[model samples]
Target: MRAMVYRGPYKIRVEEKDIPRIEHPNDAIVRVTLAAICGSDLHLYHGLMPDTRVGMSFGHEFIGVVDQVGASVQNVQPGDRVMVPFNIFCGSCWYCARGLYSNCHNVNPNATAVGGIYGYSHTCGGYDGGQAEYVRVPFADVGPALIPDWMSEEDAVLLTDAAPTGYFGAQLGDIAQGDTVVVFGAGPVGLVAAQSSWLMGAGRVIVIDHLEYRLEKARTFANAETYNFTEYDDIVVALKRQTDFLGADVAIDAVGAEADGNLLQHVTSAKLKLQGGSPVALNWAIDSVRKGATISVIGAYGPIFSAVKFGDAMNKGLTLRMNQCPVKRQWPRLFEHVHNGYLKPSELVTHRVPLEHIAEGYHVFSAKLDGCIKPLVVPTAA
Candidate 1:
């Protein structure tokens, strides 16, 4: 099998590797059919996440055919075409029973925080991801769902992460009808958040980003207003002006550690690793929303401390909600939305790279070249 292996910061290559075999009774071996390079993967690529070992594969959003299953795996069979959520968890745990699979206690040693995520890092459980010809899926009965007959492979792959996380961000907002929502970052998650806000009855949606191409996508795909923060002297003030000076009813930070508004913050957090992650987006979210409004954060960040505006949030009585999304929890409604033509997840896919050319794929995506919004990886076996 050929898998994308991480060598170090800014270094990745597709190399031949052994196909993972079932290790637990509940495990399944999936032959990947479609996989995506998520924006969060860039954090790992750039050495932002801790404990990301060399030779580890980095991919979480994937769909595949079940190649084999262990004795206890009953929900899926060898030939089943399935979409695996990014989470790896035991369904009977306290957190899983409460629909908080992302924090399942029985999976990762770091269960105090996030649960097992495929191909993330040792901190999230050193499970290898599916950016290859095959991957090992633990707790098969709880995580892998058969792809719906009506869904395309591209759409199924996105559901594994970006789509669900975006939808979860909107759900956390608790948007009231006619409320104005502003989303920071126009990446896949942000674009989807902006689009999902409309479905949640937000009267207006605005997406912010530095790139013109992504902002254009926000306007067309989400049917929302767009702003280039690079053009503004102060983005929070600009957002307030757009919301008639009271600030938006809800604000979401979809851009995580690599946010690039403040040069010093970006340097200290992203370059120097002095802080867990840059809090520019989250701080902007806190300042851009009304005093009593909600702020949803779905961006990926390191486990260490970040310099967020906790004092201001408390002073303004803002409801700040954030977590690694429980991806499977959002599938039922998301499936309905996709089935009804309300969303075309595949529309966000901009490039398709063969498994052999994945290094180039990573370069293009990291460099933001060729208008690469979302890039899919096609294994040779696919």
Candidate 2:
């Protein structure tokens, strides 16, 4: 079997490996048909995510056909085509019972805060990923949802991650009927957030990003309006002009802290400095949100914490709710949306490179070149 193996920091290679077999009663061995690279995978490539073992495979977003299943795995059969959730989880647990599949207790025994995620770092779970000819799916009965016959593998791939994450952001932000929603960032997740706001009945959705191509994609494919953050000196002013002097009802920060920051001088005055949150988009979101509004943060955050100007939020009585998407909870409904054509999550998939060309795919996507969005790595199954 051939697999995309992580060699080291910013290094990946297509190499031969053994076909995976079912290791647990709840496990399934699937012949991967289509798999897409995600922004999270970039973290591993950049060596930002620790504990990634050498020779580990590197894909999570996928839809594949089940080749074999353990006796206890009953939700799907050997011939079923399924969309595997990014998180490896057991369906029954304290967190799972509460619909928090990202924090499943029964999967990652070493996880003190949150459970393991597929193809993520060893800090999450060292489970092998889907960027290969075959993949071992743990908790397969609970984690892999049967892909409907109507959904194509290309289109259904992202239901494993992006679409549901975007919808979760909108839901957590409390987007409601007739509410104006602002989504910061026009990456796959940001674009999805904009679409989600529309689906959830927002009166208007404004997507913000520096990339013209992505913003255009947001409008043409995701069906939402957009703003280029680099063009606007003050995003708050631009958003206010569109909102008739009031702010949006819901504001979502989909880009996270790395995209927005400022340098600070130390009080000691020894030429020391620190970099932390400036809340560039969050500040605009706070200013662009209506009084007593909410902010949903779906962006990935690093280990460090940063500061945000809470005075405005305090005065406005804004509520803040943030989360990584619980894909298990969102999968069933998102599947329906994908099956019904209400959501075309695959529009964000702009690149489909062969497994041998993964290095090129990484370079192109990492540099955001040639209107590249989410690139799908199409590996040949063994």
Candidate 3:
């Protein structure tokens, strides 16, 4: 089998490797049909993720056909199409039972709070990712989502990460009916956040980004108003103007560190681009809201610690919630939304390239070329 192996920082290549097989009663092996690269993967690609092993497979967003299954996996049988969760977890854990699957203690043995993940790093759990011919899935009965036969694989792949993460962000935002929601970054995650806000009944959805292409995609495809941050010297003023000079009801930071701004100056700066709902965004959101608004952050963040101004947050009487997105918790609902035709997250797919040309796919996706939003890696020949 040929898999895209991570050689080192900023290095990945397609190389021959042994195909994975079911190794436990809870295991299953799926022949990856379609997989998509995530912006989080770029952290690993750029060497931001620590303890990244050389030659580890690198992908997490995927949907596939169950080529093989263990005896205990009775819910799904061979030939069942499924979308694997990015986070690795055992269903019987305390957290899993509580629906906090991402922080499952048994699955992510490598970390103190959360255990493991596919294609992330040693820090997250060193399971190999799905950017290859076949991937071994653990806790298959509990973790893998059965894709409805009616849905296309390409369309279903987004649920594996971006769509669910976006939905998770919105759900965390706890937007009220007719509430205003503002999402930073206009990337796939940002687009999903905006879309989810609308689905959650937000009256006004504002997407912020400097890229005209991304902003255009948000406005045209996602049906959200977009702000070209480059055009405005003061984005806070624009946001306030839209919100009657108050901040948004819910402000979600989807870009993490990728967006431009200072992390500490969140309270004072009108334009704050910290992680999802950074102190800056939080402050602005507090200002945007009517004294008791909720803010949710689903953007990826590193371990680098920063002091949050709780005093300011307390004064505003704001609610702050952030999660890595227990993606498994949202998968079933996302699948239902997709099946019902209420959600068309496939709109995020801007490029599709064969597995043989994955390097080209990375080049284009990383460069954000040709207006790329989310590039799907078609593993098998169509």
| lDDT scores of the candidates, listed in order | 0.93, 0.79, 0.78
Which one wins by lDDT: 1 or 3?
1
Candidate 2 lDDT, 142-240, residue by residue in tens: 888877778777668888888888889999988779998899988888888888888899998888888899889988977788888678777788888
Q: Model 1: which ten-residue window has the lowest total lDDT?
A: 105-114
lDDT of 1 by residue, 160-257 (tens): 99998998999999998999999999999998999899999999999999999999999889898999999999998898899889999999989998
Which portions of model 1 show Cα errors greater than 4 Å? none
- Looking at model 2, report the run of 10 residues with the lowest lDDT sum: 265-274
Which regions of candidate 2 fall more than 4 Å away from where they truly are? 257-280, 310-312
Off by over 4 Å in 3: 261-290, 307-311, 380-382
Which candidate number has the best TM-score? 1
Candidate 1 lands at a TM-score of 0.99
Candidate 2 vs. true structure, TM-score: 0.90
- lDDT, candidate 3, 1-382, per-residue tens: 8788887666778888888867789899988988999988876776666677898988988888888889888778888888888888887788878888788888766776555678888888888898888899988888888887787776688888888888898999998899888888788888888888888899999888777899998988678998886687677787888778667778887876343444354322212322222344444454555557777777665554434556766887888888777888887677788888777888778888888788788878766789888998877532
Assess every candidate by TM-score. 0.99, 0.90, 0.90
lDDT of residue 152 for candidate 3: 77
The full ranking of all candidates by TM-score, starting with the best, is 1, 3, 2
Q: What is the C-alpha RMSD of each candidate to the true structure, in Å?
A: 0.8, 3.8, 3.7
